[model samples]
Target: MGVKALLSKPLAAYVHKKDRSWIENPVEAQQAVFKSIVRKAQATRFGRDHGFSAISSHADFVQAVPVRDYEGLSSYFNRVKQGEKDVLWPGKPLYLAKTSGTTSGTKYIPITSDSISNHINGARNALLAYVHETGNSAFLDGKLIFLSGSPELEEIGGIKTGRLSGIANHHVPGYLRTNQLPSYQTNCIEDWETKLDQIIEETIDQNMTLISGIPPWVQMYFDKLMRQTGKPIKDIFPNFQLFVYGGVNFEPYRKKLFESIGKEVDSIELFPASEGFFAYQNQQQDKGLLLLLNDGIFYEFIPVEEYFKENPTRLTIGEVEPGVNYALVISSNAGLWSYSIGDTVKFTSIKPYKVVVSGRIKHFISAFGEHVIGEEVEKAMQRTMAKFPTVELIEFTVAPHVSQDKGASFHEWLVEFSREPQNLEAFTDELDQQLQKLNSYYYDLISGNILQRLKITGLPRGTFRDYMKSQGKLGGQNKVPRLSNDRKLADGLLGVAKL
Candidate 1:
């Protein structure tokens, strides 16, 4: 066997060994990670002020630190950006990973040496886990492409700053560069459309076997390739066997992506963000992702039902149970202390700590006490679309229409479709039925006549794309909001569609 194939054996062995240890005792592994972080950061400002040096157990740590969001931690981050050393983490950060800021203004997240190591190792172990399970050694012999943002980083506050994907690309091991596609020059193009064209030109004929990206952009790339070559994606890259994706749920985009691929391929979902690499799909047989318990991130969860209370109880790894939606909180080596990243998740397995993203804390629709979340809406959409095989959804967003012009408040969904449903009324009815079955609050509201039925506006093709472009968030980790508590985003989208 060649050297490349031989390399997989040792890597797979290492991953399996570590994974076994973690799975056998996830609670112990998390406690160990938490202790290590406290020891390392004990001298830092946050740790010292929070009494981390005196803390000896999880209960003490919990008592010392309170849950904080981005707004709460902004001051400390601002100090770090001003060249303050040992503020959040030890010494100054090596770089900052800038968030896409879809919900608010841009945020500069710290990327320290230790945190970056976790990111790199977590990603490597994820791939190793896949290989260990499937014994797919030939994957390494061919090219693997990561369709990501531009790699050209800019200087901010005397520190290098760029998108998380670009920062990750900068750390790609020298040995793996040979099998990676879209040469560094191509990855540096700033404009997404220009970069897509360049990427297609450079990789259309390459021996690509693995592709990693968000589902929507990858679909766009595949569509452009088919338009250019007059052939399906599998014909262009027959060796393509794995599709790695993150940043958004795969359910909404699965059918269209498979149709674009024209064949079945193994897929792995990841839960990565600017804050940290949180979880990854570890087993092919399991639907939920295995939470990375031993990573540098220390996790805390607040029950979503009580999240808005004056003081919500924070649950540690040992306290979390299956089937409950919780707002995830973390105290990472990157300097965040008990920070809520605004995402909600439901645990599926407690023994090994497997979870699935449920929704965002701020991105929910509770206009009339329905309290509908992204997970409910997504599943509803999936059921609705399953009945109309001819129609494919491109993008959609929902908001409350509170104006009394109709005498009752109703939810409005603006949808962009690749193919129109045969009967719009039937489609909307199916959507409403699925939602009623999924959410009891929404069902009660509709049945009791407190809220009118859901209404859908068929947006012209490319409405979401246009709105994102108009907002200067055209690509790379930017997505249109799926649900809004108010009508601002939905109305803006409608106004843009009219233009």
Candidate 2:
């Protein structure tokens, strides 16, 4: 083993041992984090306004602060952007994570000095957790590629501003910097395709052992690699043993990724966002991600069914139950108070608080009250794929198709397949049946004849890629929405889908 790998083993074990302290005392750790952040921010403008000084408990917190999305918090964020100190957190934020918002045009999420560690350490410890468990630190010896946004930043009110991934690039540990690729200059290229091409050129012959990115984009890289070399990724990067990914669920892309790799390799799933680094897959055998409790954030969970209701109940760490879908809310040291990051999660285990990202609160098909979520659709697709081993999917999305002539409505699945099932109708039927089994509301709607059975529209290969390219979201944490309530994305997709 090289010096880095030799050092990493003991360090990973130490980190894992320290993490057990927080993981074993979930509620206590959360309570401590809640008190610390709230007390620290008590003198800030937002704290003063929200009665943070007088708050004593979770109930007091609920009374003092209301849940808000980025739009609702814009007034305070505006002040921060214009260089207002102590408006949200104490003094100025270290960085502003700029992201494209749906209803709101652009969003600037604060990242304070105290909170940046959550993002940085959360990713580091995920690897450590894997290393400690499996005694595999050999990847530390080879090149590790993080397919991310440009490391370049533009200043907003003197605070560094960029995409979260780009911002993270600035903080990679000095020890690992030597092993990280592609070159900083190549990473700074503005266009994703250009950057990807540069990345391939730079690292095609390197001793790459770890590759990290959102699944679809990583798939794109793998496809490009195979096209260029006419070989699977395993042959090109024989030492590559780890695939670290976040943003989107991996199952839909799992089969394709493994096929491209030519073999199975260990992988890590992370739940990271501009708001905070929330969770990571700690155990290779487990599907759920270990939620970070002692990080600089206090978490709340609102039952997703009641998310749109007035005065929705917000439950703390101690109150959340396993298997319940909840809209994740957080108050972090970054100055966000009861902020809804729009993600919905279901706890698979509460002992150590392991959760699976179920769906986005807004990313669901509820046009007919069926309320099918991203998780349901993905699971259904997974089941269908399992049933038909020959079937190979590139990407897919679900949208409601309401008949213009007052006929029955149905869920339309836009799918891009690399290898179509021998019986496409049978495949569609299996997918629909799996969805109905997972979602009772959808089952009821189908059974009541209010909605017809789901229909599958075969999209030509690269259709989704072309669509993302047109939208200028071709790579770097961008994901095609799995479900949409309306037909905007569906209509746009159908135009180029060639029927």
lDDT values of the candidates?
A: 0.87, 0.93
* Model 1 agreement with the true structure over 1-499: per-residue lDDT tens digits: 5567579878898879967887788888889989998999999988888998899987798788888887788888888888889989999888999886655588999999889987887777788888888887677778888988888898877889998899999888776788898899989887888889999998999988899998888888998999999988999999899999988888889998899889999988889988999999988889799999887898999999988887789888999999999999998888888989999999999877899999998889998899999999999999889998888988888999886654388999889888889999999999999999999999998998888889999899778888888887776777777899998988888898873
Task: Compute each candidate's TM-score over C-alphas.
Answer: 0.97, 0.98
How many pairs of residues collide in each model? 0, 0
Residue 152, candidate 2: Cα error in Å is 0.8
- Which residue pairs collide, candidate 1? none
Number of clashes in model 2? 0
Best by lDDT: 2
Candidate 2 Cα misplacement greater than 4 A, ranges:
404-407
lDDT (C-alpha) at residue 410 in model 2: 95
Per-residue lDDT tens digits for candidate 2, residues 66-157, read 99999899999999999989989999999999887755777999999999999999999999999988988999999999999988999989
Steric clash pairs (candidate 2): none
